[model samples]
Target chain A: MAGINEAKYMLGESVRMLKSGKVSNLISVIIMGFSLLVLVIYILVTLNVSIIIEKGMEEMCVYVYLEDGVNNSITEDIREKLLEIESVRRVVFVSKDKALEKFREQLGKNSDILEELGANPLPDAFRIQMKPESNASVAMEKIAQAATGWKGVDDVRYGKKWVEKGEKLVKGFYMTGLALGLIVFLSVIFVISNTVRLSILSRRESVEIMKLVGATNMYIQVPFIIEGAIQGIVSSLLAMALLWGVCSFAGRYLPGLGFFRFEGVIGFIILCAFLGSIGSFVAIRKFLKR
Target chain B: MLVYEIMPGEKRIIAGVYHLSKVLGRHFALQDINFQLANGEFVFLVGPSGAGKSTLLRMMYMDDIPDSGQVIMGAHVSTMMKRRNIPRLRRRIGIVFQDFRLIEDRNVFENVALAMKVAGIGITEIKHEMTNILTRVGLYHKRYEFPGALSGGEQQRVAIARAVANKPAVLLADEPTGNLDPMVTRGILELLFKINSGGTAVLMATHDVELVKSFGQRIIYLQDGKIVKDKEMLFRGNLRESISNSRVDHRAKKFTEHSIGEDYDGKRGR
Candidate 1:
């Protein structure tokens, strides 16, 4: 009955209470499954969409073409200046010959058409990649203004409109996901609280006896919180399993559906545990009063 | 050290109720009820069913707060207590009930052990104290038996063991023998008297006026939530011997006598 052993025993007793409340716990877990399912689907959408957006943003780069009859030295100077641009992450020069080869490869089996042409029509250009965090349209305008006024520079091009739209969509998606996630997190806590409340209610006599015998609120609360947390934990795991099954089945027809990593899944599970503990804590607050 | 000697005639009150008042529902249960229990005092609270003895006892243990007034246990004054300190206060006091109130899930030893466990007593010490208390109550052999297997009298013994396990400053018994037969009641009262002799102030609430009168000790009788009488009685012989010669011992002696004689009669008949 020393502090450590008493605490250890109380934790064990809480686990026993959860496991022994077969019908009630099963009902709680099922309710939790539905709640977590809502939460997990939201998390999955947010994670996968964020990954796709990151990949797309990585490809949002600018292409700067050089003037006709521009010499190699000027092209080198141009590349060095392009690197100085704040938004310009990297600059790769593709010569006339390499450009033609790339074009031929893009044409696939129609490369004979390019061979029939008397001279290579491809221009010497620098493929400019912007910084990952660079504003799409703003960076495009800056590079355009800088390159157009420079010697031997012809034009600067980037997919400014689409990239800007994508950024907006990503921001909106995250805001909505965050709001929805908050509501569902609170809902999950409520469910856990109800489950823990019922368990405490069933063991009301024990609580009274414990109070009579000098148990502090913390001592009485540990077991109920444990019961609720177990419910939260099991429910979240169930939601994850269900989500995994759906994703695996969907992955056959929809690519990138199963993009969630282990860390994301672990984070969700930890949140579920939090919801359970908080929920039970809320439920037992009134009972602890004198 | 001279605090007592300076006022040599003053009694050191270990627990007392000062002008205690309680209201249940629309009616006042207890009003201006004043009394003190000094160290080692064995007092009887004799009252009818609705006399608010239970309410007064609950206030003593802080199970219920009084509408007005204070309950003093040792140095603790209930009215001014900080909420966090109630558990510490309860630890200094022990309570026994008419129903035994032993946790059904635990066996006899565990029932007694819980009181000490809540006080964070070590497991070895809990076991040792439990053995001592259970042995004193003649229930050491039933230590592993569940309350369901115990008779009402044996269950009451387990309750007594639990209450006394922590060596509380004050022990409150509210109808502790109400559910037991006369013989068992005599044994329970004797155990209580023995505990009182060990310097634990005992305030027992019962309706058994004859038994209360026989104690020749301080008695407080409540009627309509008011203390009608608070005085000492006079009786013959010692308190412990009175219990030994009470109806319980005579019946038990007769029962043993009948068992031996019946065995001889059976052999002769055979």
Candidate 2:
């Protein structure tokens, strides 16, 4: 019962402080909201970029262009051999006529130029798709090596250079983002904690009087901690709301990113509450040294 | 009802200091001072401005811990005390400052009630106790007024009222009348005396030499972080000489009487 009463008084006191310091609290919320908004955008954009780049890498293929002297039996033998490789998911055999037909369909009205040549010069090719389990660069290398000296193969080609460079760029971006995220996380905590420290310092008289009167450390700390949590909660909601507004506005011009995921929204609120508790702890850490 | 009660035949020491020393940033604030205050005793801790009177009183209430000694109050002694036990120890003791230390935002009643509120006393109990203490301090009518609305004397009365609201076993006041004028000081002193009469051992540190000289109470004089005097006084003020001598100023006699007692009564000290 005594604990309940103390909690009630501390909460009331915290709310009173918040209400009295409106301008300062509002400014802090705005700054935190803006910072979090930037973080949200960075996270979502990186997530989408990573997904797109990874899908493109997964679809990478190695093409084995055939030598002109290759017969049907040789081409068939090469296709069967390519499929025997452990990393190969499937081997697609395209005859010269089939390749010409695909080119004609893609060129549309330019098919007349292709027909002017009378006979097709395009080579039969074997397209190799690697298992999803294999890394694009590794699978491409293995398949290129196995097919390079094959009886029907003239030239071995794959998009390994472009895909490898894309993978490196993505890995670098993720590493930099992780490092920057840590700095931003700590920076936000420091900024909020210092703000709370100044607020507590301004009320030094109250703290001294409370201590002199025999109020427990818990009694003194409860109000400040609750105040910090509330600030965190408020800023979180405000930042999310602002992000939602921006996302909705942008969604009209672009598609699919119009709303934040439910998990992201909930995670952000929890983060705010956690940060608030931490900020409060940092602010009042000095006074409770005894 | 939760007041720290002195059992009928318990030991009499309410607070004690033994070889207590305090150092602050390279300077010794108090050095090897020892004193014991018994139940219902009122002692005037007198010294010059830098004489460690405030430091001694602060140690009495555990606001300032000693550097190299023990401050024994009940079973909670310095250095042996746990962090969680400090507040419990404080609840049994009360302290008043030179500045009233009233919460400027809270009203007179709320300021006094805060003592009980912080203790987690029930609302009905707090209301009854606040009403009684405020009435005794003669500030019941100004209950709704903030500390800013009151004069220095009234503010000190609120400080006293708050300090004693919980019926603590000991009250350590550090110059409760330091900011008030002479007339206001008399009233505040009278009020303190009234509270002292109720069995709350009062230890007040003051630099008012005339007030100390005029009154006859236990005096613990301090100087240079040491106790120059710790003996009690049976009585002081020459009431008989003022009544017989024609050269004695009438205003001085009246001031003397008001400063001490109206009937010039004697208070024995041990």
Candidate 3:
């Protein structure tokens, strides 16, 4: 019962303190919101770029071309060998005629050029699709290398140069993203902690009075921590709102850009609230020790 | 450790300092300071500027620990008490400052009630207790006024009310009337006396020797980090005889006509 009463009093004190520093609190929230918005924007950009890269990877397939005049039995044997590979999910045989037809379709308005030179010059091929989990460039390279040495196979290609280069670029992006995310996370903590310190310094008199009157450190700090959490919630919500606005505006030029999921948004807000409490805890502990 | 084992009986000494020494920087801020305060006894800690009066009171409240020796307040010992227990000791003692350190943002009632609130008293009990305390300080009507709205004396009264809100055993005042006019000073002193009469010991520190001299309370004179004289202890070893509740006004009347410092020193020299 006493604990309940103390909690009620702490909450009342937090509300009272928040009300007293209305202008300063609003300014702090806005500044924190803008800072948090920078982080959200960075995250969204990274998320969308990764998604696009993943979609590109999903569409990629390794193609094994048979030698000219290869019989159906030879092609069937090659296809069976390709299907035996653990990474290969499905393999479809494209006949010479079907390959030529695909070439004409790809030419669209320029199909006349393709028809004039065609004596069904295209070779039969096996299009190998890997499982999503096994679609990494390294796995594709291994499959392509093994198939190139097979009998009756002219060449096995998975666009190795493009795939390897793209993989490198994606790796570099993730490395930079991780480093930048850490810096942004640390800066947010620093900003929030310093803001709380300033707020506490402004109310130093009240803290001193509370100490002199025999108030425990816990009693004094609970209210400030609550205020910090409220600040965190308000600032993060503002950040999310601003991010939505930015995403909407940017969507005109970059359609199909992914935003945060509902769970992810809720998680971000909760993480921010935790950060706020941690900032307050650090700041108040330092002040009280002095 | 063994000394802390001895507990005070009813009406016995409630606070004391024994061979207390504190060094600030290279110089000794307080050296070999010793005094004892009986229950319901009012004492003036008289000294000039830089005489370590504030330092001594701070140690009594366990705000600063002694470099050597110890301070005993109720059940807490400065050297032995844990840092976490300081607030508990503070709740048992009231402290008033010269600058009237009231929270400027809070009104008088809220300022006083904060003490109770921190102590985890229910709102109903706080309201009940606040009425009696504010009425005692003669600020019941002005409870809603902030500290800035109150005069120096009124602010000090509010501080005192807040300090004693927990009904502390002793009130430590470090030049509480330093900024007040003489007329206002007397009023503040009378209010302190009234609280003292109701069984709260007050140890008031001041540089104004003349003002506290005629009060006829036990006076501890400090100079350059040492106790030059402890009046009652020096001449009258029995503290009860010199500072009985009934003899306060009688002693005040007797000391009003003479300079007690000169008279006492002369007798000591002889």
For all candidates, the clash counts are 0, 0, 0
Best by lDDT: 3
Say which candidate scores most in DockQ: 3
Q: Model 1, DockQ value?
A: 0.36
lDDT of 1 by residue, B31-100 (tens): 9999987555678999999899998999998888999898877655676765666676666678999998
TM-score of chain A of 1: 0.85
Reference-based lDDT, residue A203, model 1 = 78
lDDT of 2: 0.76
Fraction of native Cα contacts kept in each candidate?
Answer: 0.44, 0.54, 0.79
Best by TM-score: 3
Query: Lowest summed-lDDT stretch of 10 residues in model 2 chain A?
Result: A1-10
RMSD of each: 11.3, 9.5, 8.3
Candidates by DockQ, descending order: 3, 2, 1
Better of 2 and 3 by lDDT: 3
Q: What is the DockQ of each candidate?
A: 0.36, 0.47, 0.61
TM-score of 2: 0.83
> Candidate 3, residues B35-102: lDDT per residue as tens digits?
88876678899999999999999898877889999987765667667777677668768999999888
* Candidate 1 residue pairs that clash: none
**Candidate 2 local Cα displacement, residue B133, angstroms:** 1.7
* Local distance difference test, each candidate: 0.77, 0.76, 0.83
